[model samples]
Target chain A: MNDKKIKNVFIEGAISSEFIGRSIAKHQTKTSIGAHNIFLGQVRADEVDEKTIYAIEYTAYKDMANAKFHDIREATFKKFDLTCMHIYHSLGTVKVGEICLFVFVSSPRRKQVFKALEYVVEEIKAKVPVYGKEIFEDASHQWKVNS
Target chain B: MNLNIKYFGLLTEVTLCSEETVPFSKATVSELLDLLFEKHPDLKNKDFQVALNNEIVSKDTLITANELALLPPFSGG
Candidate 1:
């Protein structure tokens, strides 16, 4: 049960580049980590029915989503030799061309980091109960579903 | 018992309220859903799964007095 808890993943709005840079900087002291893989999810301006998506408003069943993220984190650690993993996602409106999700994974070798990064991102896409409603240029909205 | 129920995402569009405490007798998840459908007819057609205490539960699961949320499909990256 001690391993059941995890760090919070939700950020109020879009994740900034400076924060991400600092996260990477903080890990430099750990000489054991040789390679790091980063995955940044950006909001795309997809055209739907002549309406262009300007922003995505995100919401989640936070308690459950965080728990699922913890499960994913634990599973990823068990499956790979990793130094550390950090995940942060936006909770509110993230505009077009904005970074919404940041996943950082590090390992002692390039191969482990490569494999582990994909596993964590894919697991989050499939399991986390977070919703995004796409707001169009004309102020219309539609719920987004992962393909 | 008065149970607390929460709705998220698209389901909140139908219920209009995110959380509510409603009176309920002991029942299965499916039966509680039926009551919800009666209150918000629009929810009957929405696609979602029931979670009791943060874990997704099947319709046959007995209703318990705890955190309950109706979660719509995820689109998160």
Candidate 2:
């Protein structure tokens, strides 16, 4: 939580399972963490006007998005008793059923991880200056709005 | 004053460009928006907020920074 570096939270494409597994494996050195919670956001193949979504193309105002992510990380640490946390969001094309967002939070106790993980995800959904273009199967697209 | 104006999300589609340097003599965010509306009339109907130097600000806030961004509703996770 004391880490103040402005970590880049963006990945060029979908987050792979192997990358996630590696992240977890690297945390073994920190035996102080008693509980870990994770949240993965997948691209849903939603239908609109009879057309199904095939993928989403993501973009962001990099400077502002990173700043917002940093603020959210700092705020979450202040609000929760978390041992560590990591967040990653996808940029560019992400196919349906692929992972676009990943949040990992660890704490010394079970309850803190549960609360901190949800808080971080909700804050990212509300505050980050990132955009998604939902591309339909017919190659048409529409801007995504978070409900 | 000359300012760096950035368009994001749907705003970029409306403007047909992502970022541009615009010269403005305005003192407030609302006044600056008026100038943009004249150039891109379609933007007047779009739902968005203005960020002055990376912070969301009210329309009446004084223009103190040389950078501004038009941000539509965020859909990030």
Top candidate on lDDT is 2
Give a tens-digit lDDT track for model 2, residues B1-77.
89999999899989999999898765899999999999999999999999986789999999988899999999986
Give lDDT tens digits, candidate 2, residues A1-147: 346678899999999999999999989999999999999999999999999999999999888899899999999989999999999999999999999999999999999998898889999999999999999999999999999
Badly placed stretches (over 4 Å) of model 2 are A1-3
- Model 2, residue A146: distance off in Å is 0.3
Provide backbone clash counts, one per model. 0, 0
C-alpha TM-scores of all predictions: 0.96, 0.97
Per-prediction interface RMSD?
0.9, 0.7
**What CA RMSD would candidate 2 show?**
1.6
Candidate 1: pairs in clash: none
Q: What overall lDDT, based on C-alpha atoms, would model 1 receive against the true structure?
A: 0.91
True-vs-predicted CA distance for residue B54, candidate 2, Å:
1.4
lDDT of 1 by residue, B1-77 (tens): 88899988788889999999889888899999889899999998889998987788999999875567898888997
